[model samples]
Target: MSQPTVPPLPQIFNFLQLAAQNPTQYGGNAADAPELTRILQEIRDLSIPNGAQHSAQGLEPYQSIARANNPTWNARPDLRPKISKFRIVKHTHWGKAYWSPVDLLGLFFSRLEPAPLGATVRTFFLPMTALFGRWAFQLVGHYAGMQSCMWKIQDNGPAQFFLGASIVGYDADIPTCGNWRRVIQKARYSLLPNESLFLRDWSFANSPHGPIHPKDDYPLGNCAELYPYLHLLRGVDESNKNVYGIALKKKGVRSPSYNDTLQGSVWQNVQWPCVKCRELIHIQEGVLANFAPYAGSKGAPP
Candidate 1:
């Protein structure tokens, strides 16, 4: 069935104003416009998730990266799994840009308490600990769809970025179940503690016991490698602001390198010492995708 027409926001807004003033003039907008009215009611009934709104520098360093750097500067694609069970469709196919802002905002507010599955879970879990400003696209106009980027984090993980896709419309019946199913089905299992991998092999790729990494600076290989994933859902970005800011100040994540003389968007592109062997691995997205069983086993002369 086609989606019922949503009354013009202005009309709805006016109805709300009337109801608020006398509350008896129209018997409340809810009875007049149940669907649109349901939204307002839901918003009133919603609550923010615990710890979902905390802002600590240590919790959300990614916002800093966004403040200092641009997301579109050096975007890349992911290449592992070599086969995508999932497809990236333009947002127009789903809806129109008309409903983008309000829908995204509502979704963000609605999911604050218990984050919705898939992107909702990923976006909120980061709190204020992300090292990349990948979630900045949340503020763009409705022409863009929020692509949920997945990441295989080592010690710390940052929010993913978004593509310039437009949001032409909105869906009241968000396929919560189907979305979660597909999300988990094509999921890239993470590397074990300190065990990062590039995942060239399919067998090892599915294992959940590995540390995942970015594939490259452009064209991310897996959903995790793609920065645009941050835009998957609308409000996921704003929710992080308040909490991330608080944590940043409370924890003080300003390392001298964060303010390094290096002038570029990839400064947060850091490599960590292996906890097991202490070997300094160049931890860009490529290293994560090119991981081999042993040091010399990778990219052999075939």
Candidate 2:
């Protein structure tokens, strides 16, 4: 016997129309459930033709907007969404550093062939996208005062160094930023008065690991550790060499996250010591409890 064939989305759309008009006559949730299934299957059945005129180059712009409207689908699992490919900045000239989720969708749909969608699919796509926009807007609301996530300014040695010497897990208790700052300041000033540092507090959200990129590193312990690190990096400007911004967050907390270390730029022309001890100075593998002890870190380099 042959398998039964699945009907197209038009059939599903018609079915929903009947059920909505007479829910009591049909069944309530059960009646609507199949419609939902049909919509999902229809969505999955839709495909981007090979060599489709993709709006974004490597699949990020295309993937993000499509996935936002329809959750149960993905264009490619093993790839990161290349937002740069969309060029909303270059094309639209919307100067915000990040794209609003709505703008992302707008950029995407504008590039696609405007084939009429099945009624249910169209219904699902539009309202669902609106909800996604609202959600993203709410998430970014916290970033009002701070234009972007905390960023590392420089990695100048003395005042600025890598906190990657450490790793703290969620299970440990940590000190406040003030205390960590005092410790690093004492250590930095013990060497020199003016110093600039990037503390871990300004780096990661304290998630114990790096996401998107597979690197195991931490910056500094707290915001307090920032001044001296920055002071030192600036202090050694003539001799130091290396400049890059590294933003990070803490390892374990849920919100208002923590930091690992500060990352910033190297002096424009200075050369860094390739042989400097990568002995895991400021940050290293340890419980969160060990962070305070490493505060001054005078007797031993982390």
Candidate 3:
């Protein structure tokens, strides 16, 4: 039998360089698209394991790490045998973006409430929390939905930042799941500095653990669960009124393919696919409406 060959260090380094230089083009429109895609595919293939068929082959290390991180792992000693047998492939093949077992467990808990899996059938079932977390963080990139774009400060300023959005669950009642709300608060604070941060969408729903209703006024905070991951864009400014308008028009005018809608684009683009763009448009429209009629009037509020 022959040993499997791994990608060369040089190739990996080159990929990283390309990714850094032109983050959007590297994945979305690189000249070496086929080759780059193939490399990524190969890396993913080598990293993630298949289903339970191969679960027991070499998963002890991962299971041990998970148990070490999860305080409640030992709470159900009866399920230990099955939990020990559970195989979780949580890391990504891209760069050093691998997730520790602890990270995976944290994500699991964020989206789901833990439950006792009786010993009789625990072996055949993976926790829903674990499965959903993996799907949202890992598999989401395979589809097309909203694109992540970075905005630089205009006129050669030193600030450049990203607005992060994920399909993570949100419940005002659950302190652990309130990360999305914190992100919004941070974005609002950024606005005072003439900088902006916006995420794709967030979830607003009644809490599963308590009687907490999602805030209807903070509409920008609700994001659907199945939105596709988007390619990141460079050299856009979210704060500039002109720049923001252009980006909004570009997204709004582009016709989504039928396939896109079928694949959950409707959920993704519900109110506005990009929350920042919507805010910008609202501001621009308000200004225009207030000023357009004053063009011919004398001594307007210039």
Scored by lDDT, the top model is 3
Give me the overall lDDT of model 3. Answer: 0.26
- Candidate 3's residue-wise lDDT over 1-302, tens digit each? 01112234344335444553443442233444443443334333332233221123533321111111233334655554333322223343222121222222222222121122221111111112122222323322221122222222244432222222232221222222223344332332322212222241222222112222344322332222111111112224243332211111112112322111212321122223344334433432322221121122232122
Instruction: Write down the lDDT of every candidate, Cα atoms only.
Output: 0.24, 0.23, 0.26
Clashing pairs in 3: 202-222, 202-223, 203-223
Assess every candidate by TM-score. 0.19, 0.16, 0.27
Give lDDT tens digits, candidate 1, residues 15-63. Answer: 4434444433433223333333433333222211111111223322211
Which candidate, 2 or 3, would have the higher TM-score against the true structure? 3
Give me the runs in candidate 2 sitting further than 4 Å from their true place. 1-85, 88-236, 239-249, 252-293, 296-302
lDDT (Cα, tens digit) per residue for candidate 2, span 110-189: 11212123312112222222222222223222111101010122333112112111111111111211122222222322
> Can you give the lDDT of residue 65 in candidate 2?
22
lDDT of 1: 0.24
